[model samples]
Target: MTSRAAGASLPGLTGTPLDPDQEEARRLLQEELDSGDYRVEESWLVRLWRWFTDLLPDPASFGPLPGWSTWAILGVVGAAVVAGVLFVTRDRWRAARLSPTGPAGAVLDGMRRSAADYRSAAREAMDAGRLDDAVLEAYRAIAAGAIERTLLEDRPGRTAHEVALELGPTFVDSADALRRAGDVFDAVRYGDHRASTDQARAVLELEARLAQARPELGADRHPGLVVPS
Candidate 1:
């Protein structure tokens, strides 16, 4: 009966029944082939999606973000970046506007003009209503006159404030004015300050007073000069 059943089951079978273990193995193998798991291949996009999903938590655990929120966050970040860049550019531009030679004294750097020359330039600038130029020229005159009278050393890089400090004891009455003039020079030269007509006149007046004033006998010596004992 078993042989007859085997022959009837398949035409190639030689009327021989398969053993119980062999039959069970064949059934399991057929089930695996019919499932199509081994024969199917995943596309690159699907594989990439799986990899990305593996890094994230379950979608059910978190609510989806509103579509507008993403753009809002990006816009805020972009604006912050733009503001930071503008701030840096402004600082660098300010630095570029300043003299490259040195401090406030740089206004007179490399110029061999006499104090009288600076005074002439100041007068011309004031007449033309170029108050900024007038202020600068007046400050230069002060610096040049100090060097000529040995009140200040004829040195490069000596700032306006340093010159004022050195001449303060000699010109005791105008000490405060000297300091203020130095501040004004720095503001007009390096800062974004605009010199008014009154400011220009004040600087010119200070320069004139400094020219007429006499330094103390002891203060006449330049820092670079040495007197033999």
Candidate 2:
């Protein structure tokens, strides 16, 4: 619609009555929106949707979000960046909690040692047909290792999701081992669930490999471990 044609009669975004500039903006926005799907063309609406989707609020910012002022928008972006950093810095958080070194290498060291002890305990328990103890031991081992290696200083800890993030791809193999063991451990611990001998064996093997591999890599933190520490 022409700017003049799409007058006060046009619907405002919130369905409120249109003011002159609003109507004009809406008309312009509408025109941009109506420019057809950005499919092959990437319409302005699609771009706006993408932009807005990217503009999430900070967790610390709480609620009562405002209109897109430069500062508010910047806040949203800053929040997103902070969230990303926190996510990626999870290993550092855990390590700091444990060793005060915030060193990924040290954390991994702890994880490996912990994993070995847990695996041994779990194997013994599983062999004796004590599923409950095996499961419990598995988790305890991981937690202890995480504390010693990842969060030693912060006994009785928090989420490792944040900590695993800071670890580089090299650390991923060990992390994967921890995650797999964790899953099986959960199934056994959280319920009266039964795992087959094969499943239990798999979990043990993964944990063992992770434990061994971690120490071999040495305590040198990956450059990607992100040190300001």
Candidate 3:
């Protein structure tokens, strides 16, 4: 009896008949392997490439989104971004609005009083034992000094606290004093707390300091001033 050779192809295995499509696929696969395009599964680069390809969107499998829906999604995202920006910048915008150069200052175009007058009034009030009036006048003197130095612009209806807030940056060295004077003025003018001669004197001292002080060069300048935009 004759036996088949060890390398001989069998009909059930290597010699099985292939359809046209299968034959073409096998031929393409062989060509790819010969051209070094076929990578082994054990290769790290091959695994990484497969992972990256899997993560990509399948355009053919998933239908494209409608134009309106896409636009709506984009619009919502854009609006959210704008809202976030506005929220972050709300304080800055408010500061700019309340600035001497802003609309807040427009109404008080010519309503500014001289610092000397305010100081004189403060001294008179102090001599008269009217601590409340002295505090108010002293605080006004500080504001007047700020205006004279162009560190602030006069605006009507602005509270003492508001003025201090605006001038705090301009008087970095005297920021605490300005704020304290504002608080004292507010307490005497608005609150039920009565002003004392000491408090009035403190405000006067702060006013003197502010009057002698120069404008901070690095301070945020008014928009009307010729500053680097």
Candidate 4:
């Protein structure tokens, strides 16, 4: 018939006895509290704020406190630095993911072949009446030849329009041909248009012309500059 205070024992069934381990734990907790070694319960927000402040450098350790404004400025600067670092790291990771050997393998996703190989393929496709394939191969041959002749660098994911633009500035004499070829290729590739034998033949003829075309160096060009072999 003894009454116990709410904090004297753990609340459970009215007549339930405390286990020996529980009693020991309660005794230890009480001793710690009496000795002022126990921490008071903190709200979640206060705990999170404490953790965040712990991550920052101590202004008092650096020097005498200028003011609260100085601490606020330091906190802002620290946050900006962290944000900038995170942004740069994210960009580098994205670049790596888009690399030739990365997961996407964007640079190596397309068919890699020599100009002669592409020409052979084009001929076979044309003979088989695969006009679309023929046109695609013929365009590939043109791009391959330009790379081989050092007229253009082999860049992945370059659209036909981009190729034509690149060629126009370098092979001024074949600008019209390059543009036409690009237009035809883009129409077949992206515009849902069917390729014709004539279009394929035109692309092949343009490729041949571009293979022989050279860059028109202006008078202001470096006289000592040696062409890439």
Which candidate number maximizes TM-score?
A: 1
- Candidate 1 worst ten-residue window by lDDT: 9-18
Return the top candidate by lDDT.
Answer: 1
TM-score of each: 0.50, 0.36, 0.47, 0.46
lDDT per residue, candidate 2, 98-137, as tens digits?
3312211122223445545775788898889876666556
> What CA RMSD would you report for each candidate?
17.4, 19.3, 18.6, 17.3
Clashing pairs in 1: none
- Please report the TM-score between candidate 2 and the true structure: 0.36
Predicted structure 3, TM vs. truth:
0.47
Residue 95 lDDT in model 2? 39
Question: What TM-score does prediction 1 earn?
Answer: 0.50
Alpha carbon deviation, residue 117, candidate 4 (Å): 0.9
List lDDT for all candidates, in order: 0.74, 0.52, 0.67, 0.67
Which residues of candidate 4, in runs, are more than 4 Å off? 1-109, 217-229
Candidate 4 or 1, higher lDDT: 1
Q: Using TM-score as the measure, what is the rank order of every candidate, best first? A: 1, 3, 4, 2
Greater TM-score among 2 and 3 belongs to 3
